[model samples]
Target: MSSDALWYFARGSGVVSLILLTVVVALGIGARSGRPAFGLPRFAVNLVHRNAALLSVVFLGAHVTTLLFDEYANLRAVDLVVPFIGNYSPFWQGLGTVALDLLLAIVVTSLLRHRIGVRAWRTVHWAGYLSWPIALAHGLGAGSDADTWWLWTISLACLAVVVAAVVWRTSAAFEARTDRAVRRVEPRLRAGIR
Candidate 1:
């Protein structure tokens, strides 16, 4: 395939990943907001959120690796991690570097959560929110196929996940109803226990 075609194809992948990343962030927000204080049964929510974040990371890995191989991009694996390591676009490279910093912050915080303290770790972990926008900007700025229909579709889908998550968390009725459901279940019966 031609480099242009491959570049667009990679951007297509980027679009899908953007949605996945958005979902991870949204779920992370929900999982964070519904702490023990809300008495909203956060165990499952947190679990899903954590898994979502991991999946997002996986998607990001795929996106970066694929981009590196796109002949149109003079990107190395180090460029993905080191930000401005790309010789092609110095300004966009800087943006990538910032995004890389955020990704690293999130990964390091998650891995060291115990030592960092929950509050501090969570605060740092919230940087996942910044990763999407930075990535979106990089895709648009550096991607050769930013205008492709698939790319737009993916971007919109990612936007939808963020919107849905915000709506769900802010819904008073949903929270109250879910809380009642949890109460009905009984504590010992919570985790598939008899």
Candidate 2:
């Protein structure tokens, strides 16, 4: 395939990846809301997010796979993980490498959550926020399709959702902290803890 085609292809796949990441973020917030989130809404949100994440990863795999097929892009599968090696575009190629690394970390952390424990899983999963931006940058910088109006529109939508999710997570964390402070002061709460 032509270099232009490969660039457009990666851009499209990158958008799907971003959308999946957003779903995962939404699920993560629900999971943090304590036991109160055991209801259907929380369950659905978590389910969709998890499924989306998996799908995103799948599309990412396809995106990388296609890069190899597109001879003009001159990318190998390893370059998907290695960065700076995709002969299609070297200077900006490393961004994909960084994003892929972050994604790998998240997947490993998630798979090991049961064995490593929830706290460890949480610490690693927090990397998702940073991964979002890195992925976006990779798409925009290395993408052959970056200049398309449709691509720009989709990119903006992804950015909006990411920002909203971050805001919600921050708000939830603050509320949780506030609640903990109040609970810490109440004699009943202290007794329950003990």
Candidate 3:
């Protein structure tokens, strides 16, 4: 297609990827929250998370490919792997590169989770949290239409959803930890072990 069409396709893919990434993050947090929904089971939540993550990856591939093909962006293939190595809006594009690298690591470790061990997999998975924000920043800073109201609305909504999920996760973790501490202290007090 023409350069203009290719550019539009790239921008569209990037926006869709961001939306999918938000879904993946929300599903992951929801699953971890451990609250049973009306009909959706934990397994289903996990399955959706995994599938959405894969879908996001696919869109990301499209975004990268279209950008590379669009002469206007001037993004070299190597820029996809190596951060800050691209001539295209170097710093912002580099953030995208870093986000992509983190995502790849998350995906590979997830696929190999059984063999690599749960602890290792979890450690890598935390990088997903980092990747999401880096990607948002890249999109906001690098895109030509960042000033558009629609993009800003979507970005803010995504941010709100993720932030809410994080707050839920953190409170749940803290509560659980406090419960365990209380349990430990109660047993010691009863046993006179002070």
Could you tell me the TM-score of candidate 3?
0.84
Task: Give residue 52's lDDT in candidate 2 (0 to 100).
Answer: 85
Clashing pairs for predicted structure model 2, backbone only: none
lDDT of each: 0.71, 0.73, 0.89
Tens digits of per-residue lDDT, candidate 3, 1-194, equal 99999999999999999999998887787677564322467788888888999999999999999999899999998999999978978999999999999999998998999999999999999899889999999999899779999999999999998887777667766468557768978988999997
Per-model TM-score versus the true fold: 0.71, 0.75, 0.84
State the lDDT of candidate 1 residue by residue for 80-178, as single tens digits. Answer: 666665777866765766776798788888799999899998788777788877876776676656677866676677777777767877799768966
Among all windows of 10 consecutive residues in model 2, the one with the lowest summed lDDT is 33-42
lDDT of 2 by residue, 53-139 (tens): 889888887777777777667777678677786676775778877887888888998998899999988888888767877878777
Task: Give the Cα error of residue 193 in candidate 1, in Å.
Answer: 18
Candidate 3 ranges with C-alpha deviation above 4 Å: 34-39, 170-194
Model 2 alpha-carbon miss at residue 1, Å = 9.1
Give candidate 2 regions above 4 Å deviation.
Answer: 1-11, 29-31, 35-40, 171-194
